[model samples]
Target: MGIIGINRSPSCGVDITSKNDQEVAGEGVFIEILRKKLEKNISIDMVGIKVLEIEKALIDIQRLINTK
Candidate 1:
């Protein structure tokens, strides 16, 4: 299974997360934990979903699904 998260969240964003009102490129808290917990499995994909970039997110999700 895969997981999708909001890209603008401070704790859940996967790529473009907000920090002090400024956007930064990095992983969020939950993602970090999940990664550490699921490091043994490489087939599970994780992606970030952006509100403004819905089309891109959809495409990414589709790709993830196709991989599985």
Candidate 2:
């Protein structure tokens, strides 16, 4: 399964999580926990979405679905 999250959120960001108003390259706490918990059962592919990149995100999601 795949998850789409906001890029600027602290709790739900996938690739650009927020930290003290700075953008960092990391996953959110929940994503970290979920990854470990579901590592054995399912393939998890996550992507960060930005408001400005909605079109790109959609394309990425389509590609993910096609591959699966």
Candidate 3:
């Protein structure tokens, strides 16, 4: 399975985060830590999305589900 998180969150962001009052590209601290732990076992997908961007998020969710 994959993880879905807030795109602009500082703690739960996956692909985007709020750093120094600016949005930047990177996993949040929590997600980064989790990824490191999980990577030791098996690789999995992580995605970030904005609540207002439901359509795009849905596509990402579909892609994650379709990952083999």
Candidate 4:
């Protein structure tokens, strides 16, 4: 598996690995912009072990989307 580092926060660094390397990937600002643009269409799936605060952030994002 190839590991790619993502700058999330000082507390929790992010990484993405692939069984096969051909899959496309991006992180941080790229992800944020992609997510914002994707809001009207679908959800993106992320697999990882997250810290408590990061999980909370995810929950907050879900809430914002759900409330909208």
Candidate 5:
């Protein structure tokens, strides 16, 4: 799981294990790239599952946003 998380981080950029040390930028860009890569690697069935997980995470973010 740790390895997967690291691989999914924007820090990975276009490389498998490379890290992006951007001094400036929002997290959205990083997440978007990682998600695109993940979708490209997995099957359609798995994509659905990953989408659901993303939806849940978005919901959680909404909650946090509301709290702010």
Candidate 6:
């Protein structure tokens, strides 16, 4: 129903990603690809969080689940 990724990851980021040493706003490679693949059949929500902020990430996941 939802997807969660680490922010600033080159392959999994959802909101922030490292590009040539600078952080930019965009989805990472994998998430972007997955999104495109899913765009045709579903409307899943995706979110990103810092790795150290696992607690917040859990809350985000809960929210994603609740929206269903």
Clashing pairs in 5: 11-20
Estimate TM-scores for all models. Answer: 0.82, 0.82, 0.91, 0.29, 0.25, 0.87
Give the Cα-based TM-score of candidate 1 against the true structure: 0.82
Query: How displaced is residue 32 in candidate 2, in Å?
Result: 1.3
lDDT of 5 by residue, 1-68 (tens): 11122223344322223235533322334544656676787522111112236775455445544553
Error of 1 at 68 (Å): 0.7
lDDT ranking of the models = 3, 6, 1, 2, 4, 5
Q: Write the per-residue lDDT of candidate 4 for residues 1-68, one digit (tens) a residue.
A: 11222334322223322324332233444444555676678765433333455775566456545653
CA lDDT, candidate 3, residue 37 = 99
Supply the TM-score for candidate 4. Answer: 0.29
lDDT (10s digit) by residue, model 2, range 2-38: 7877787888887778889998988878877877788
RMSD in angstroms, all models? 1.6, 1.4, 1.0, 11.1, 11.4, 1.2
Best by TM-score: 3
lDDT of 1 by residue, 37-66 (tens): 888766467889997887898899998788
User: Cα lDDT for residue 43, model 3?
Assistant: 90
lDDT of 6: 0.90
Provide the lowest-lDDT 10-residue window in model 5: 43-52
Against the unseen true structure, what C-alpha lDDT does each candidate score?
Answer: 0.82, 0.80, 0.91, 0.41, 0.37, 0.90
Worst 10 residues of 2 by lDDT: 59-68
Candidate 5: where is the Cα deviation over 4 Å?
Answer: 1-52
Q: What's the lDDT for residue 52 in model 2?
A: 88
Candidate 3 ranges with C-alpha deviation above 4 Å:
none
